[model samples]
Target: MGVIPALVILYFTIKGYEDYFKDKKIFLSFVAGLLAGFFSVLFESFVRNAGVVSLIVLIPFFEQIVKTSILNSRLARGTEGAPIYGATLGLGFGSIFIPFSMVIYASRWSGLDIVGLSIVTLGAIGFIFFHGATGIYIGYGVKSDRVW
Candidate 1:
């Protein structure tokens, strides 16, 4: 479970380094992304209470907005490394956020429900990749001045 997220992070971090060298600030952005994920989880609990329609619509919008809020801040402005930084941040956010939720789900399993556990594990892996890919897109957008 944990290994998948770590690999995702590693893949993006390596890609970021290879494409844009010597940018240490990505680590900081990565930390911020983790915090963003934490806060988004907190915020989602509130949004989830609003009803199914809200859950289906608002939650995703809210998550994306909250996740990328840090990248859109003035701190990232004019930074030539914005894309790589964003990717790293997204990597951090996905790594911590997705696995933590899956761990909770896994803990709730009764006995050895391999099928249920397998589904949860697969979902986690899929989400990690989704988050990483989204982060890369957002990062690239920020880099090109096309994303707010």
Candidate 2:
């Protein structure tokens, strides 16, 4: 369900910055982000017993960390394109996050109507941006030699 929107956003966003990257670095970073997203989902599954607070806290913490792992890629080395690549990676992570969370919370799933659905959509968008912004921050940090 969420995959289409995620990919749509990812495609438009990355396409705009494609000129900044060389070879397949941008694509590689996105793939790495997808891997990070899958890894986070699998990792989260094994730790679901930690309770709700952890779901709101620890899981996201770990995820942001993992999503940023793309920053370590050879394609992400240059400062000029780091943030763009980072955002791509982050959006890629967002691509999997919705399906991942839907599965994790399936037992508790409930349909929401207009208002509730709107809120959920907004929240998802915000979180996707959260991933992108954090990626940008870390990527920028690396570019600035802060050693992200």
Evaluated with lDDT, which candidate comes out highest? 2
Residue 88 of candidate 2: its Cα lDDT?
Answer: 72
Backbone clashes in model 1, listed as residue pairs: none
What does candidate 2 score on TM? 0.74
Candidate 1 positional error at 28, Å: 1.0
lDDT of each: 0.66, 0.70
Q: What is the lDDT of residue 147 in candidate 2?
A: 57
Question: Could you give candidate 1's per-residue lDDT for residues 1-148 as a string of tens digits?
Answer: 4445645565646673565634466667767777777787778766767899888888777767765677777546456666666666666666665566665676766444777767777676666566666776766666666644
In model 2, which runs have C-alpha deviations exceeding 4 angstroms? Answer: 11-18, 110-122
How does model 1 fare in lDDT?
A: 0.66
Collision pairs in model 2: none
Per-residue lDDT for 31-89 in model 2, tens only? 78778877887888877688998889989889877755558656676568887778777
Query: Judged by lDDT against the true structure, how good is candidate 2?
Result: 0.70
Worst 10 residues of 1 by lDDT: 16-25
